[model samples]
Target chain A: MALKRYRHDWLYSFCSVFSMIAFMVPMLTVLGIKDGIVGTLTRRLLENPRNREISPIGTRAFRPEFFEALITHPDAEFLVPETREISATMNLIAEGYPSFDGDLYSSAPGDPLLSETLDPQALSHQLALGEIYVSQGVAEKLGLSEGSELTGRVGRRQGARNEYGRLPLKVMGVIPRHITPKYNVFCSLDLARMTEDFRSGYAVPELGWKGKEKGSEIPVYSRFRLYSRDLDGVERLRLHLLGLGVDTLTQAAQIKLVKDLDHSFTVVFLALFVVVGGGAFASAASGSIDQVVKMRRSLAVLALLGISKLRLLVFTMSQAALTGFLAALGAEALFLALAKTLNSYFGGSMGAVEEVCSLSAFKLVAAAAIIVVFMTAASGCAYTSLADIEPSEGMRDV
Target chain B: MDPSPQKTKNGAKEASPPDPDVSDDVILNCADLVKTRKGGVGYRLLVESMTIGRGEHLALIGDSGSGKSTLLDMIAMVLKPDSAGDFSFRPIGHAKWHDLWKIWRKGAYGIFEALRRSELGYIMQTGGLLPFLNVADNITLPADLKPGFPKAEKRERFKALTATLGISHLLGKLPSAISVGERQRCAIARALIHAPSLVLADEPTASLDPPTADRVFELLLDLCRDSALVVSTHEQNRVLTGRFKVWRIDCRPGGEGQPIEARVAPLKDRAPAAALPAGRVSLAKSLSDSVH
Candidate 1:
């Protein structure tokens, strides 16, 4: 019966349904654009793997226990110990290229920079006792490639005398320029420790270089470079390192910008929803009131026919519910079309993984539910007129 | 009008009180029912005594503003009387009589609504068919409101009634699409479709032409053979020629500031007695079954 009434007054019903669609589609579109834009920006920030790296600004002796505890930290993805800046440099000479100095750093398993270019297990295997990995900058400067033989010479000032140690090295791999943009050389922890010891005027029996005999000393690292498990973990790891009096540098500001962008979009969307949604609600409610007033004769006839007042109320509300549900469906279809158009228009510039407008399936369902509920409430606001229709009014000549 | 009129303190004539020994054949009995319309030129309608017998045909005739519609509304229980000395109704085949005024005072509107659904039917002057529905749906609405009305029986009656009313062709059309005469016939069909024990038609043909009004009025009277009927109409000649028991409202004009007073009184001839059809079902039993 309610459906019959709705169908009988299709023009009025159409207007009400369209009003609801007008309210809902804008809200859904704004939300989708917000999610898409913010998601794309955040994804762009995460594209550079180095953005997840946290390195201390200056040097300090960090104990073995500190390294062990830091590795157990929840956000720590990868960590490697480094020697002092003075001993970390070496003069490299390749057969076909001019000699140049390369900054040395320790390399170990799960080194994200090397793992980005080569498999982690393979990279670990290649970091043997006399092997080294060179950055693309170093490779370009010294004319180095994998399997190329090179000589790394370290010179030390020994009380007005210049002492030099030479080590035979093979270029095991070259890290990508994007991963390590500076001219640097990477070697195993044992090799880096030996270099630091030789620079401190100690003997390195492995290279048969002469100096003071080695003594028992607990090894301490002057610096460490760590990568987080993900982009979001960078700030957490940086803060954790800061708690230990070490100020670390990472791309936390870029991540904050994305968060702020999300917040701003939400506020703007809410304001739009309040204004447009209020108007739509008023339109739908007043339209329902007008329809009920026009149909009071028919409603009174039903009452005169002995249909309960409660049933009459249900009849009126059922029509509103139908209108709301239909509007939600219309809004969903419109939103999908708009989202597709926007995504297509912007998809060329952004990568395939990023969309300019997007909404999750869960959000779509939730929006539909909310629209239906809202429309029903709007109808409820007009129930007084329906209830006031008297059955005796059906007796009048009018 | 053989009964003597007694004068009230306000100088209005009051008809005799209702008969205390109501027989089993009587359907409704009322006495001393009063309703006051409070407004400029206040009006009051008084029904001193009245009775509608089972299978009886009664016509209410009066001038305009004489409270014919008000009296009919009160009898139909749609309008509550301000006070009642006695108002009782016995549904056909029911052993017990229901106190109509007591039910009203209790605010038991559902009972009144259910009675209207299962036992009484009303027809308005303008053919009060729902505009959204087709003629067929409008006619079947009363039966549809009944919870367990037999669909096969309803269909059979619908065909017979529409055929009888000459409205079989207009069943698929909406009320707005039909003529006034056709709509009136449709209203008659709706009022009789449920087989109610009482049918009230208030100027059912007042909007139709002479021939159509005659035809519709005759059809309404003919189809109500097995039920009681109270019809209010201006077609006095036809009603009198049909030999229906006539009730007229007599109003006394008010003075400059006083309210007008009116009372219902029986006219000369009672309707000719007719035999009841066999196997008439009790409206109470039907109502009870349909509701519960």
Candidate 2:
């Protein structure tokens, strides 16, 4: 025997190992690429489920704790969407100020809507109790620019029966032009709460600058977002919140449908590869067993020496196991390399670099297990020959 | 004993162990043993009341279509006999047939395999040593399978026999590198390694030259000193009645063929160590090197 290679009988065994590896690489890589695309897109969508999904159902008259409980999840958004709406009348002169109905885009600091490159501190303040970014259309009509002092108010559509006054404000930068929809006027949700449109209390405090207590009627939000950790957890969280009588909505159903699609694809690929890879392994193992039968003299000698047919079969099993293990090793390396190359080529929005490319450890194990089962079953095909061997029969052929 | 039996002019002595109190007990007892397989003209074989005891030898001879090898296979338990009016081996201290039957009901091969490992030895014609193992490993192969391993006494006997067969120096070399004579020597050593009660040889010296064949045949006699040895060969001329009791089988051709018929014969040499009186070739000094 050479240092690296096995002796004559095992030479067939080594060739089988290489053939199994070659078969495994291309099949596993193709399946891995599909999984990579689905997983990455799914991850990006799941990162911000609350907004893309409609606001979770909530009651009109729940205690403040209701919103607080929803806030417990990291990505939950508790918005009063009604506050973002207003009818702007620029002035109360004989000729009213030029006005347009528009929405205020207010959010929590890490809202997916926030630009990714914004300075962290300013970004946090911009979500609430800070200067506002106005839509380009709104800025053009209002003739507003960054650092311009501006007055804010509850427009008459908020109500004609109440005596509420405009509040002072400054226009911050215009919303980045690249983000869609140019007419939005962004502000802090805290600021939005001061508008007469949200106030339902008895005394509107003379409207110089009404503190939260003077307004006293807790604002009811038209919509809110409640984020959970992952797609599987979303359903559980939704059920619990629903048990507490809060109406909720999320991308949970859509996400589940997408996930089901992904899972179905994975199962199909697994079945396909098992048939292809397992067939390859079975063929290799059968050839090796035939070689063992061809070496029947050696087998008969062992039998005469009292080695039972069952005991001698261990060598065949080990040959299969060795080939399966090496093929798994080669397949994983090739799958990972293929994933990296494809991810880099497609780049961010179009490709999922980390999530979709590399095969999961679970998949690698399953592929190996399938190959081994096929090989073991194939090796058993030689049992009749082994059982037939005898010392006298070996002599006859010699 | 046949008075016309002849002997060879070789100076080889009957090789038996050095022990003084060797027991002479019956080793194999069988009558009307029959075996048949489908689709062959050499279909059936029947043996009537063949008995061999320890420290004895039996030679089997037959025409090409007769059942010499088939009988040897049945004796070795490598093939099951279809019918045996009575068949038993009286290996001392072994399991009773009834108990072995209990094991057989679960799996027949298990019983055969266990018995082969524990009691029977087989020597194939081509020196069937495994190509991967060295001479020493091949010689000790049976010993290794034995449970309470090293079977100290058996190991010592193996060492002694290998030494006698002139294979002790080649113990570390693989079968592929050894000469045919040396490989045959190892096969002989392996058969005797466990000191089995019976040793079945199927034309064991057919691979060797004549002189080497004689030497190996003599060594087999030396090693199976206490065994009931059954050897199958086609050469009637080499049979020595003083050493071997011969049985010949022949099945004549017919449209459907006749059942195998067997008979016994004697081959004479010059004389057998002064144990028997002079005759022709001893009935002859060599049965005229007969062919039949």
Candidate 3:
């Protein structure tokens, strides 16, 4: 009993140990890689214009309460993409900030800021009514700091500066100086609504175009970019807004391709687990059977020496558990080291996206659980061998 | 009321106390102990009555088809009897005859294994030593397997076994590396190292050459001088001496509507007035009638 559990034929030993580690390490590695990819794909999928667009389906215009209803959805974030020409100076009263030709942007803060933007968080704060965040170019030209105010004139695109009304806005913050085309201003919807030009509602937008009939008389949005908190529900929200006779700008093929990629990764992970898990289990079971067949005489000898069937069974189970434990240790060591190396590799490539090539607590737990299941099947073989063994050779089955 | 009871002499009429490991006078008593099996062919083994005392050696002999091994296994409680009657061994509470050992009748195999490990030792034809273990480990195996069997005295007893068997220098070698005689000597050591009262050796010397077999048998008989040794073998010439009694076990195939028949009897030598039992006389005649 002492040597039996630890001792194995070279072939059996190599096969069992190799298969165990093979099952654990590669499965975990694939899962980590899948998670890294899924994280990126999910983010990109949600950030895609196809998933975030909203517009009137055809000739129909939005109802008076359509905007309010869409905004009330838990996942929905309403945005007005219309830009109006404005001329402004600093706060209500002061020596005044340097005024410049600045284009104003009005939208919710959670919008997917362009990847080309060097400092994404520079405009991370939400814009309140009567407040604004200026890009670095605008900030430098106006010489505005935090708590400074800018007086802007909002009117027709060709309206004269003195012809427009004065719109006083506070400069709450400044965008960092990195991204190009930095003369942009960010403000809330309420601030945009205060402008007389925007107050004159425009034509309702279609799926991809903001236009009105040659002769029509109804309030319409030039364009609106819609967003959902979770991409899983984004399609449903899109359908809801589309049901309201709105056509959203969506590349269904691109979104489906990303979603299909996500599903493929899931299938790969599961298939990898089954293939590896099945191989490990088969190796364990065969190893157990081989040991029993080759060591029958020895087992009978032990039985003759008075080791009970139960102890013999436990002895066999210990071998499997020990094998699994040793394999897990080796696999984990290899897994963690590999994850670290690949983490840096992925980090170097995907900038600012979290969770690149990292393992989860659940994977370790799953590996342990799989090892236990393997041991259980292996020990079952041993138990059967014990049950079949007779105390002595040439003895009749009784 | 005396706590310690009196021990009878060898082959005594009465059994000794429960603790027989230290006692010299001990007896194993049985009446009508029987064992049987049936299949395409049938087997019925029986021992009408018998007693084995400490320092007594019995050589069980028979023809090629005789049930010598079966008889030895039955005596050691390795095989459950077809039907057993009025049997016990001493000392009274020795594990071999304890309440647990009674499970042999109920087919409680674990109890029989425990009895074998702690109370009796078995030596099979092939040495029955585990291949992976070295000579020393095989010798001490029964001791370790026997729970609560004086674990501290193992080293001392092992040293004694090595010295007695003259295999001390070969302790570290695997069974594959050893000579046949050396292997058999190791088997004998393994049997006696645990201090079992009864040592059942089936063909202990059957596999050795004549010269090596002689030496191995002498060593076994010598070491078992203080214990109850029952050896089953075909080496009748070597065991014909007065120091050892011969027990021949024979099985006669039964006819239709009748049970398989078997018999056990003492094979005595050179007694003109002694007539063998009628059923056994003819088989005995061919042996005794021949000149030695």
Q: For residues B116-181, could you state the per-residue lDDT of candidate 1 as single tens digits? A: 888788888999888888999889989888768799989998999999999999989999998999
lDDT, candidate 3, residue B227?
Answer: 71
Q: How well does candidate 3 reproduce the true complex, by DockQ? A: 0.26
Give the per-residue lDDT digits (tens) of candidate 2, residues A22-105.
Answer: 787777776776667666657656644432444545324444566776666554443334232332222211113465545655
* Better-scoring candidate (TM-score), 1 or 3: 1
State which candidate, 1 or 2, has the greater TM-score.
Answer: 1
Task: Pick out the ten consecutive residues of candidate 1 chain B with the lowest summed lDDT.
Answer: B6-15
lDDT of each: 0.82, 0.62, 0.65
Q: What is the TM-score of chain A alone in each candidate?
A: 0.77, 0.65, 0.68
**DockQ, every prediction:** 0.55, 0.26, 0.26
lDDT of 3 by residue, A321-365 (tens): 777777877888898889888877777777755556656778776
TM-scores, one per candidate: 0.78, 0.70, 0.70
Provide the lDDT at A172 for model 2.
Answer: 56
**TM-score of the A chain in candidate 3?**
0.68
Candidate 2 positional error at A78, Å: 8.5
